[model samples]
Target: MKSIVLFGAGNVATHLFRAISNTRNFRVVQVYNRTPANLVPFQTLVDTTSKMEEVKPADIYLIAVKDDAILPLVKELIFRQALVVHTAGAVSIDALENLDRKGIFYPLQTFSKTKKVDFKNIPICLEATNPQDLELLEELAGSISEKIFRINSEQRRSLHVAAVFVSNFVNYLYSEGEAICKENNIPFEILHPLILETAVKATGMSPLAAQTGPAKRNDTQVIQSHLELLTGDQQTIYSLITQSIQNLHGKEL
Candidate 1:
């Protein structure tokens, strides 16, 4: 079995530890975090440590920390022979350039410690400077997930930006929708079906082809009505998005 030392105790790390532990081919030897309190969750399940010196030798050192923390964390590791990979999406593999066996093992999905995700459905994006290391990552990825992609740093960076637009930006829009509903004394849950349907349709067909509503139809009367109902900040956001939709659909105003 391939032994792994996972760094970080965040959402991604928590999920990965669970998913990887389920597999028979790999085992997480230890979980490392700078803060001792953060290691509590893993202490009962695996070897947990707050010190870099206490880290045990492993076949793979999986760093699942924040993007900014990646480089600084890697510089502190003394293991040069083991394959070291990070779970960051935008950060390039160049961040680990100082190490011999360096790669990226980015999972393309939003993570939350409270939510359980099926790693089998989630896409694991892998990149490595060495061919053998890339194959090793593919093997490890396949152990937990069925979907795997060999993406270079440039492509991975672009994918990360696109993910932010789809996941992060769209979540912000959902919060705005909820706020509007709450202000009107309407149950935000009323929009649940519409939200699910929209998501399903977008996935099943081209989003442009699936497009509908006042913005896409350029229904100026309806658009004006929406703007009038919104707060100042919400009105600005509504106007901007409406204009963007119209522009994409080859319409103005």
Candidate 2:
């Protein structure tokens, strides 16, 4: 079995550990975090440490820390030439260039500690400086997920940006919808079906084709009324998005 020393105890690291635990191909021999309290959860399952120097020998050192901390952590890390890979979408593999073996093992998905994501379907993106390291990453990714892609730094960065648009932005819109419903004394549950249908439609068809709204239809009067109902930041977001939608389908007008 391949041995792994997982760094960081954040959302990505926790999920990665759980997925690896389910598979017999890989064993997380050690887990490290800067805060000792964060290592408590993994201590019973495997060796856990707060100090980086005490990290045990492993086939792979998986860094799943915050994007800003990745570089500083890499600089301080002292491994016995173990293959070092980070699970970050926006961070470049070049950050690990100082290591003997460096690569990226980014899982392309929004992770939350409370959310349960199926590793079998999540697209695991891999990149390595050498073919052997690439093969190792590929094997590890394949063990957890069937969907694997060899995405470079630039492509992964672009994918991350797009994910922010589709995932983060969409979720914020949901929050806005809920707020609007609350202000009107309407049950947010009424929008649940619409939300699910919109998601399903987006997956089944192009987002542009699935789009439907007063803005998309170029209904200026309805748009004006909606903007009048909104205030401050809400109004700004509504106006900007409405303008964008109109610009996208202006020919229809």
lDDT of each: 0.93, 0.91
The model with the greatest TM-score is: 1
lDDT tens digits, residues 1-253, model 1? 9999999999999999999999999999999999999999898999999999989899999999989999889989977789999999989999996788999999999888998999999999999999999999999999999999999999998999999999999999999999989988999999999999999999999998988999998899999988888878889999999999988999989
- For model 1 the TM-score comes to 0.97
Q: Per-residue lDDT for 1-253 in model 2, tens only?
A: 9999999999999999999999878999999999999988888898999887898888999999999999888887877589999999889989886677999999988889999999999999999999999999999999999999999999988999999999999999999999999999999999999999999999999999877989888888998899889998899999888888877876443
lDDT of 2: 0.91
Q: Native-vs-model 1 lDDT?
A: 0.93
Q: Single out the weakest 10-residue window by summed lDDT for candidate 2.
A: 244-253
Worst window of 10 by summed lDDT in candidate 1? 225-234
